[model samples]
Target chain A: MTMRLVRTELVDSREILPGQWLQSFLAPELSSGSRAGQFVHARTGDLSGLVLRRPFSINTADPATGVITIHFRTIGRGTEWFTRLRPGDTVEMLGPLGRPFEVDPRSRHLLLIAGGLGMAGVRSLADEAINHGRQVTLLFGAASARDVYPSSLLPDEVEYVIATDDGSVGHKGFVTELVPDYEGWADQAFACGPAPMLAALARIAEGRRERLGVAKLGRKRGVGKPDVVGSTAARRKAFLQVSMEQNMGCAVGACLGCVIMGTNGVPQRVCREGPVFAAEEVAWESGW
Target chain B: MSPADLSVDLGRGLVLPNPILVASGTFGYGIEYGDVVEVDRLGGICCKGTTLQPRIGNITPRVTETPGGMLNSIGLQNPGVDAVVAKYAGTWAGWKTPVIVNVAGESVEDYVEVVQRLEGVSGVAGIELNISCPNVGRGGLQFAIDAGAAGEVTAAVRRATDLPLLVKLSPNVGDVRPIARAIADAGADALTAINTLSGIALAPSRRKPLLGNIYGGLSGPAIKPVALRIVYEVSQVVDIPVVAIGGVTELADVLDFLAVGAVAVQVGTAIFADPTLPVRLVDELTDECERRGIASYAELVGTALPPKPGAPSSKGVEYRP
Candidate 1:
């Protein structure tokens, strides 16, 4: 994909949660081509101290309005700098980077799960799925009700469900606990969250085919070969895909800073090969 | 007034078009930012560290940002020397900027082998020996810490290839003067001082180390002073031209390195924040030279070093504790 350096102006910024923010930028270049699960590396104004651009998942991209939103928590100075930005302020962004989620053409039902800020990763997919007339179900987990991503921010067609660890919201438990109810109905699943939660989802996804007694169904006559691991084709065929994270630098894959251990024992760049990957492609047991 | 000349000569017929260069690891093979940066405008591009074998690099969480800088444990992840030549050498051959292959290995033979493979290859202008990678388990920091090992490795590589060789110095050492002297004596064309300083960061949870590798090399504004100190000390001792690299963010930092005896500077960590910084610095340096009314940037080099001592301090022993 062709990545561009766009000068985006801050269109709006609001604290969506206690510490998290959902800010929108008017970047026509990004909104036109960026897909769900892709990300942007936004530069900070204060360059003296923070020498690295922060990587954020494209929470939503509205081509009609030329606006793309990024959701992030103020965990450090970079995010804090973003918080002080005014509406007219302009920032440089390099994106529509990394591989995006690959949906199967025949799939009619899409299940998306996110943990805390991970909502930012999968939020856009819901809109894209709904726009395509595919049924979308979103399962979100947070520390409590106060941290839950507001339903008003999501598309109206999405079937939203919530799980809170402290029992302050719907379905008092980890979001992974709710996957069993939807796994049989969903044709494909996508997730982004804490590694443990994603790992747990991966474990459940592995048993889904057997538990439901469903055979691998979509290969055409005489064209039934396994797609290579880590390829986009492989991800489209898998039952579960996940967006991954790592401390990053030079998000364009130049710096080997943002990498995760792949099942092939090679370190995959979270900023390049992913931000999204099929469940089986990743070596979840590798504690990296 | 005529424009100031920023050309730098590192001997053996190798000359940089200007004094600004993008450091090895930060720029990848130099094509990663093709759309964003004008790569041909820079003085030189030191491609990512090439090794004898394809390296997968470190585990996850390889990089993290600190207060004023960032720490990285990339562990010299590369596609091996053969693959590098086969993949990017053709592309680099078409660029105006000279591409220096930064070579690293677990042993002297490994370094020599990588350099040998790069020797006489089209598009490869020089070799920047990366003897200071601290993330690896062995042979990386070993050659850089001791003067003898440093000299031996340099000498071995020197005998292996005739390309202009630049050995990178590690700032993690106690004293850099002897090591710099040893590398120079081993017939290195020039010296690049200094590599990243070894450091560590803890995860937010504090349950384990932040980086997959327990230790990472810290780079950026935070290590500028330390890098300057090493460049100052090493430049005074070595006869070869010193190309400084540390926290070079702007033209001022480039001038600071030159004032401290560095003939040229390589922008490393700053490229992460702004990919076009090195090219901008080149323009800024020319403007700075014009403002100072200097015809060449060489006039600005080594303006801050202490006057050479006349006959080795006679009272040196009297001050010993």
Candidate 2:
């Protein structure tokens, strides 16, 4: 909710993979307040034919240096416009928008899952978890080793695991296959990926409790309490949290453009209500 | 030269401090931008499309970007009229600008009920009848295309509330003048020319439409010329103030709209790219008037209009049977 229209200067821009980029900005007003899963709506310098501003997740933020970075691939003309910028160029951005990944204070172990470009959405959380003295495990999936996110870019404290479709990396298969290995050990899971991938993870998270045979708690104070779905407290206690993306318009609740149907039969704004939500909160099969 | 005047009077005692109003659907309830935009500095604020009942709106992929514009089929998703007035009216009453509620409904009674509820509200300043919303299945577009339906709805709402009423025109119609005239004659204080034109974009898979509802209203710079043509034609035929809205991005676009006889221009799709553009345009417009040494911006209206009668909206208008 601490949002501002700040003018950020592109201090660094580099291509880490074949077509993927890692660009950093000097935004003092935003880097500190932005959380792990929040995003910034970056406007294109050349809006000659491109009208809408592109939304990018805050990949990493360094409050000490007043720097924040965004990761993206050349998907369309709007993104291509960002690749053409040089050092010291200015970009007008509105941030840090949407809800961030809510971590329970008592949790000591955290698991993060990402697919392809979805890495940008969860990369910052590793820093947050490590800074809080929590053990972190990151499982990533990519088409091939060429597209795999470089491990050096991550915090050294993170336990990096990778799966490539072509078997050019540690595991040969989808990243979801790696979740079961750590599901029991990790207290909670966070993810950002393709819809099918996230949906598959939601299915897995839904069955984890019964699979582990965790005892159903009896009423403590007359009734067993449960967190309300889609609420911040509910997300803070959920088994799995995800950062969702959609084709956005205003990057605010106004346009009602970037929405995903919730389990409660109401459409939630990815900009205002969340970029992050509990897996149970989303109606995965609803196909919104 | 003295300070240039930017105020706008839409008649029936609804006078705006300026002419740069934010279009509905883009600004939300004027709080989405947080502190980025100075809503009090705007001439007026047209909030999101409101209906009689709470609506959840359309499904996924509700918006997409095209060349020089964007397409959206939000399907009038709102928390209903009663919820809207209960939530934001108090905050609006404290602001310096006017907040015009944009009402959308499936029937004439629905429109009247929504307006009547807002009639005596303290924060509610006026009403903009959205008779041209094209997102919903029965989204009131029928009134926008036909003169009789347009007049009927306006007359009903006119009787229900004494608040300043402005009926928005849709550019999807073949000829907009008759409908514009009917609504004006039926007691609309102002006319907002050119709602979004209907359009669709293909999905990347090429197997389906990009938007969930399959069709959306096109807005942005792509629709500016079409809006100008409508403003020029309708202004000549209607006596009420013409408020043009389609794709206003910069001060030049604002001036261009004024030249075609729009007393005010609403900034719509451009807000997605730059939230501060509307407020900046308000300042730039005053600077523009000072540069021209004009005492008031009103002298700039209708400059592109013809000096004589018989000037058709387009070259083929007279040829149409």
Candidate 3:
């Protein structure tokens, strides 16, 4: 409901990797209320044929500075137009859209994962977790070293770990490979990446309790009252929550354009129910 | 500059404060925009396409951006009409603006039943019969492609509800004049021309179509000229007012639609880029009327249109729907 149309001025723009660009915008209205995993629907130059606004994860929001950053690769004309903006250039952005990653108050050690451009989806959570005095371990993956998100951009408190397909980084495999090592250590896991990567993590998060041999202490809280499927409480308690991606139209849920198959046999709007959802809420193999 | 009268009467008691409306499917229920849009400021709010039964919509990847437009195959996803009335009708009734519920169905009876349910609903200001939806497997393109079916459904809905009726035309047919005339004669108060044109985009793999529904209704600036042509042709043939829609991005586009014989205009795909556009367009149109030394926006309507009835033009096919 706090979603709004805010005029954002480009503060700075830079290419952090080979093709990935990170641009910062000063939007007090959006930055103050935004949560990690939530996104903004940005309008491009209207003169061109780009009819749909581009949706970007609120890569990072600095309420103190009234600045928000969006990280993306110049994949199409929309992004190409964004990169052309100068420092004083202003654009309209509809934001703080979609639901953000629901981190539990009880969680202390958080595990973050990102694949390629998916890093933009979860990068902000690290800053948030550290601000809450939570320990964070970030596992990142990309096709090559040149594509890795720069470590200089991350908070120093984060235990940054990287994986490259060509083995030019810390771990030479998919970031999911690094998850098991920290599985028992992390109280909760949050990820943003390709569908396959999230699916793999979902498979891993399923048996975590058994793998760690953690027993229910006593009347496992709220034993009879179930967490309503897509509620914030349900997502907050989920072991692994992922920020999803799909081709989006009206990021405001009206268009029903960006949807993913839900395990409950209904298609859920990625813009409404989520750009983020609990791992189990999604029908991982439904081929959505 | 003196204030130009921006009000529009769509006939049978559906009078709007202005000539700008947010197109169906784009504006949701008019509540989705929250504080971003001032709902009461616009001419009207056309709610999403509603069916007799709740629709789950199509598979994923329902939309994609095209050259100057976007392709959407949302398949008319909406809660059943009853749920729509139960949930959003009260809120709509409270707002000063009229909320027209857009009805779509597989059968004429289905359209009639939906209209009957909304006949006296407090928030339901008008019924826009959507026979032109191209995304659904059946029913949609069927009623729109032929003149008889379009008339049959419009007449049935007309008998069902006393509320104002507007039939949205499809651009998929070879010719649309006959169909427009048929709907007008069948008692629709006005015509909203044209609905999205059917089109397809290939996936990046180049092996398959990009949209899950395969073919999507093409909307946005790319289809403006086609919309203008239909509005031009249909306005010439029908006595009812033509509510123009399709890629209206600015005040200029609004004027263009008006000159082509559209009494009012709906901003559809452009809303995705600028949520405040329709309201802003209302202001711009008012200013335009003031600047043109006109007392009403109606004076600008049909300015670019050629002389009426059976007049031969260098352009256009002779065939009629």
Provide the lowest-lDDT 10-residue window in model 1 chain A.
A215-224
Clashing pairs in 1: none
Q: Name the weakest run of 10 consecutive residues (lDDT summed) in model 3 chain A.
A: A215-224
Every model's DockQ: 0.73, 0.82, 0.79
List runs of model 1 lying over 4 Å from the truth.
A215-218, A221-226, B133-141, B307-321
Docking class of predicted structure 1: medium
Across A149-248, the per-residue lDDT of candidate 3 in tens digits comes to 8899999999999999989877887889989899988989999999999999999998887989864222265365655556787788788999999999
Q: What TM-score quantifies how close candidate 2 is to the native fold?
A: 0.95
Ranking by lDDT: 2, 1, 3
Clashes of each: 0, 0, 0
TM-score on B-chain, cand. 1 = 0.94
> Which clashing pairs does model 3 show?
none
- Model 1, range B176-211, lDDT digits (tens) per residue? 899999999999999999899889999999999988
Which regions of candidate 3 are displaced past 4 Å? A213-219, B133-141, B309-321
Error of 1 at B299 (Å): 1.5
| lDDT by residue (tens digit), candidate 2, A89-166 | 999999999999999887789999999999999999999999999999999999999999999999999999999998
